[model samples]
Target: MSGLREPYGRGADEAGFTLVEMIVALAVFSLLSVLLFHNVKFGVQAWRSGSARADELQRSVVTQELLRRLLGNAYPLIIKQEALQPRIDFEGGSEAVEFLSEAPVVSGGAGRYRFKLFVDRTRQQTDLVMTAAPELASAQDNSASRTLLVSDIDHAELAYFGAPSPGAPGRWNDSWEKQSDVPSLVRLRVSFHASDPRTWPDLVVALRVRADVSCVYDPITARCRGR
Candidate 1:
C-alpha cells in the first residue's frame, strides 16, 4: 500500500501545466513586449523632434548674424552711376534691397560687391535670394551668383526708416533712394507657407552710420562739397 501511494504522489507531482496556464503565460509575455515597444517608439520620436528643433535654431542664428553684418557695416561708397548723377550705395524697397558692401574676407570676393536681396517667387513658393556682383562692374545678370537666404516663404516685406528733415516725424517707408545716403534702419519680415514648424522673427537692424540728408558742405568752410 505505501508503494502505491508513493507512485501516485510522484505521478501527480510530474504533471505538466494546464492549457489555461500556458495561455496566461503567453498573454503576459505579449503585454510586456507591447509595453517595451511603446516606450522605445516614444523615445525615438522625442529624439527626432529634438534634433529637428536644434537644426532650425542653428540656422536661424546664422541667418541673423549674416544680416547683422550686412546692415551694421553698410557703407556709403559713392560712385558716378550715370552721366553726372552720383548714386547712393544703399537702395531699399518693400520687397528688395540693394547695397554696396565689402565682401566677406573668407569668400573670394575681397573688395566690394553689389549685394541685392530680393524675393524670387515660383509656382511652388517664394524664396529670398541674395545676389552679388562686383561693385559697379556691370555684370549682365546675377542669375549664376545667388545665395538663398530663406526658402518656402509665403510672404516677405522690407521697410526703411529715415527722417526727411531733422526733428521731423520719422516714419517707415516702402522705398528709399536718397542717392547720397543710407537708411537709418532696415526692417525685414518673412512668413512661410509650408508646414515647417520653425518661424523667423522680424529683423530690425540699425546702421552704425546714421542717415545724413543735409547739404554736403564742408564742416569748417561751409562751402561747396566736392564729390
Candidate 2:
C-alpha cells in the first residue's frame, strides 16, 4: 500500500498543467491570433486600394488619348444663323470634318464624323459626342451617326482663342460664338471624379485649327493664346 501510494502521488504531480499555466497559454494564443488577423486585414485592404488606383490610372490614360485624337483631327467650322436656324458650314466650304479615317462604302450608310461636347441634362453629366454629318452622304441613307464618349464628367468647357474677326481685336472667348469665326486654337478643359482627387488628370488640351484664306489666320503666329 505504501509503494502504490508513492507512485500515485508522483503521477498526480506530473498529470497536467495548473489553471494559471493554461490561462497563460490561452492568452498568448489569443494575442497571436489577433495580431495575425490584423495583419491579414491590412494586407487585403492595401491590395484593394492598389487595384483601384491602377484602374483609375488606366481610365485617365484612355480619356486623354481619346481627347488627343479628336482634338488633333479637328477641322474648323462656321456656325451661322440662316433663317433663324443654326447651320454648320466649313470655314472654306471644304469637305465636312471626318471623325474616322475610313468612309463607309455604303451611300448614306455612315456619316461624316464630327466631335462635340455637351452636358447630359437627364443624367446631369458632361459627355463628348461624336456625330456624322448629314449633308455628306455615305454608301447608304442611314448616314446619321452619333456616339458618346467618357461620361460622368463633373465639368467640361471649350474655349476659343484667336482673332474675333477681320478688323476686330484678338481675344479669348469662354464659349464659342458665331462672331468668333474660325478660332486659331481650341482649348479643352475637363474634370472628372475618382477615388483620389489628386490623382485625377483634370486635363487641359489645346488643338490647332487649320487656317482659311479669308481669315488670314496662322496658328503659329496667332496673337491669341489660352491660359
Steric collisions counted per model: 0, 10
Worst 10 residues of 2 by lDDT: 92-101
Determine the C-alpha RMSD for candidate 2 after optimal superposition of all C-alphas.
Answer: 9.5
Which lDDT tens digits does candidate 2 get at residues 156-187? 55665666556877666664444433455555
lDDT for 108 (candidate 1): 72
Candidate with best TM-score: 1
| Tens digit of per-residue lDDT, candidate 1, span 70-120 | 877776755443345555568788899888666865567576677788999
In candidate 2, list every pair of residues with a backbone clash. Answer: 106-138, 106-139, 106-140, 107-138, 107-139, 107-140, 108-138, 108-139, 108-140, 109-140
**Weakest 10 consecutive residues of candidate 1 by summed lDDT:** 218-227
Q: Could you say which candidate leads in lDDT?
A: 1
Model 1: residues with Cα > 4 Å off, grouped in runs: 2-5, 8-16, 79-87, 141-144, 165-167, 210-227
- Give all TM-scores, in the order shown: 0.79, 0.60
Give the C-alpha miss distance for residue 92 in model 2, angstroms: 18
Residue 112 local lDDT, model 2: 32
